[model samples]
Target: MFHIGYIRVPRSTWSVGRRFYSSEIQKKTIGFIGLGQMGYPMAQNLHKATKSTHRFIIYDNNAGATTKFTSSNSDTKAVSTPRDVAAESDIVFTMLPASAHVRAVYEGSDGVLEGVTPGVVCVDCSTIDVRTARDVAKNVEAKQAVMLDAPVSGGTPAAQNGTLTFMVGAPQSQFEGVKEFLQKMGKNVFYCGENGTGQAAKICNNMMLGICMVGASETFNLGLRLGLEPELLNKILNTSSGRSWSTDTYHLVPGLNPNVPASKDYEGGFGVSLMAKDLGLAVSAATEVKSSVMLGSAAEQMYKIIAGTEGYEKKDFSVVFRWLGGEKIGKGKGK
Candidate 1:
């Protein structure tokens, strides 16, 4: 029950309260670019979460993707370029593929900077190099815009389920301002210092992930070769100190882990090509800082081998197990 100017009002039956709340809300405009595998679902969730008065403007290099997305989401307007999307929005989100792609969209002639207002907040969710991320942020700042490097984790499934984890790097003043949007698309959001640290965190995490996955795959192959059952070896690894996400959650061996990319013939998960790219970024960063990432460098080379194999590049990074087992590697070469 609530009192309004000496009148008692039952809160549960107060229709005016709902009207008062709705009238006080301000509508926001959101822009999204790069409608790829992960980006598509992420944009979908953001739209679903704030469809009331928040507007969503979108753009993608692929015309078909923009058309399909707008067709389904009537409230979303598809635009010509990234700049146009930014022009019509107050907050812009980009989920591009690589550093080069991110640079193009944010720094090109008709880029986000050209269209965004001075105070527009731009968030990049691409897994790119720290150098590129910082460069982009600097450019955004030059235009008096705030930029946040917010790379995400979890595979396509987590993306679709709106449970991805975001590692964000932004100014202290701007982190809280953009966190509400991040929360719409992610289950966890970690603010990791300034400018390019988000890319740093993501690359470092992926580097260790590649190392662990490769090590686990090799260990599993060795255990099987030494006459231990695959399931038994996996159980031992999961229980012992050798346990990691590679061993327990996303195990490489088929029939050992269900509903994983390994079980689906290495489809719809983090690809070998992407893992190799992240490893290369790690190696490059290590070299820049004179840091000796011995195991990380070796893991980069291993992923490179897997990426070079035809039909293996698009498969899950865990397919290193298949390569180790000598199944589908080394084609058209004299052995």
Candidate 2:
């Protein structure tokens, strides 16, 4: 067994044609794939934090995003494929959108697995299903590399500010090995357990978030219809038992919080379709575990409606407030 920082990688798992040299392993290279809204800023913070000590490589499906990232960050190289990023880096971080995208980026032709060197560490920060995350980790292990599922919490604002919370799933030793690196882009790093548990935690958290948002929206809409002013109702909810991250931090009532998506017309935070997808994952996980999540199932359906409706699909998940009839209560109306 050889060590990559604190994590020991068994050489018996190495496949033919995979290189395992001390010099290559010592290169201190870092790679990031997927340059979406959250990934872009997370990568930026990581690059800024490690620019002086490590060589940074980035890849994205969008040429424009690649151009923008490379133009803004000096000494960063934009590669053409995930394979190339894997080939040139000792550690790779991916933050794709969903299960399929994560699979394609990691297991597809010219993907990360194609060029992954033995002892390399891969961190997937995508909030995909548990099965997929485990399957991908197994594949990485087959290649004699380490893989960690580390889905993050916090919205775009937290990502941009480098304050996101990462829920990581891996062995305790492996978690310790990667904690410092994760700290570069996030404020909190938690060890959720082996292989797929990080994804499990993320889906569960989002399930509650969806349910809370729906409940908050429904309550706020009722209060507005009952002639309660939004500001007064918001103040009550925030200080009372109704308070939650949905109500206190990202309240759906516009102008209540100037920094949230509600204030910006719900354009750029977590999209409705994404929340629907996460809720679906939660329902699936509940089914697999033979657990009951009636409220999660109900929230999943509500998000499906908002995601399927025209003009609301791409809006923030908090748009459920407007979809449920709270739009007329505030100064800003849903588009």
Candidate 3:
């Protein structure tokens, strides 16, 4: 039985319900897939913020995630595949890795498009590309569903604190319809433009992030060699206009900020694999447009080194600067 802000729908017609609860709050009952580091907390925050009238349905390739998510909410249940998530909800959110995975999840016979439960909206928060995001949206509209490329900024902590910023590529009216639901999961929201612009914004932002992290690491290491304490140097740089979100919140100055990934042995945050993937998307986009991405190119290559040599497990990207100093920094996955 699906409950939406006290409104009950017949089980058989739930497939087409326009998020009864959320539609009133301008919200929606969301189905989620890919419960990794970001997704797990994201889904949890969404569930807890809403009234009990809202419900959740989930699916993941990993059984452990299914178990953990189910354990968190007794009423929440797991499904077998991506299609199941799409079939059961008013809207679906996907936080997958790349375009390939996104395609397979929706284009495959057993994927989301199979039975999207008409009037349903599918939002892909995964940081994919402009072209892929647009194409995926076309497929969604053809099935009489809506799609938005609402990729986010601010990683795991934001996901947990519900402070993430969403750059949404969606129509104005459509975006308005889903914003209430999205607001429950995040604090900042912007409707960037049509279909793929949100993803475009994401790639450009990450291209900057890649360069900033690398710059912070290089400068910090160089300053340390020049007799400055890593922590003190980081503090000065951050306060003196050289700071970025990485330098402030992420604070690559390991052991200084006990809360960031750097202090936790580079575990429990955005995975290196995801960074590599985002940089790769940046590189590909740069190539397609023949844009002068001097810094992005170098960062993409650096990510390759980190991914291949250090393993794409879960290291904070700040570790790349340490890798530059030749100490063979941390790995995302255990070696």
Worst 10 residues of 1 by lDDT: 326-335
* Residue pairs of candidate 3 with colliding backbone atoms: 22-27, 313-332, 313-333, 314-332
C-alpha lDDT values of all predictions = 0.83, 0.88, 0.79
Clashing pairs in 1: none
Taking all chains together, each candidate's TM-score versus the true structure is: 0.88, 0.91, 0.89
- 2 against 3, candidate with superior lDDT: 2
lDDT for residue 117 in candidate 2, whole number 0-100: 72
Candidate 2 positional error at 190, Å: 0.7
Off by over 4 Å in 1: 1-25, 326-335
Question: Candidate 3 on 1-335: residue-level lDDT in tens?
Answer: 54433356664664433454423443345688888777788888877876365668888889999998899788787999888888777778888878998999999878999958557788888899899999999999997788999998888889888998899998666887678767987999999999999999999999899888888888876676666666677779778989788888897766778998878767777766678789889889989989889888888888877877744345767777667761232222111
Q: Model 1 scores what on Cα lDDT?
A: 0.83
Candidate maximizing lDDT:
2
Off by over 4 Å in 3: 1-28, 310-314, 326-335
lDDT (Cα, tens digit) per residue for candidate 2, span 30-90: 8999999999999999999878667899999999999999998868999999999998887
After best superposition, candidate 2 residue 142: deviation in angstroms? 0.4
Cα misplacement distance, residue 270 of candidate 2 (Å) = 0.3
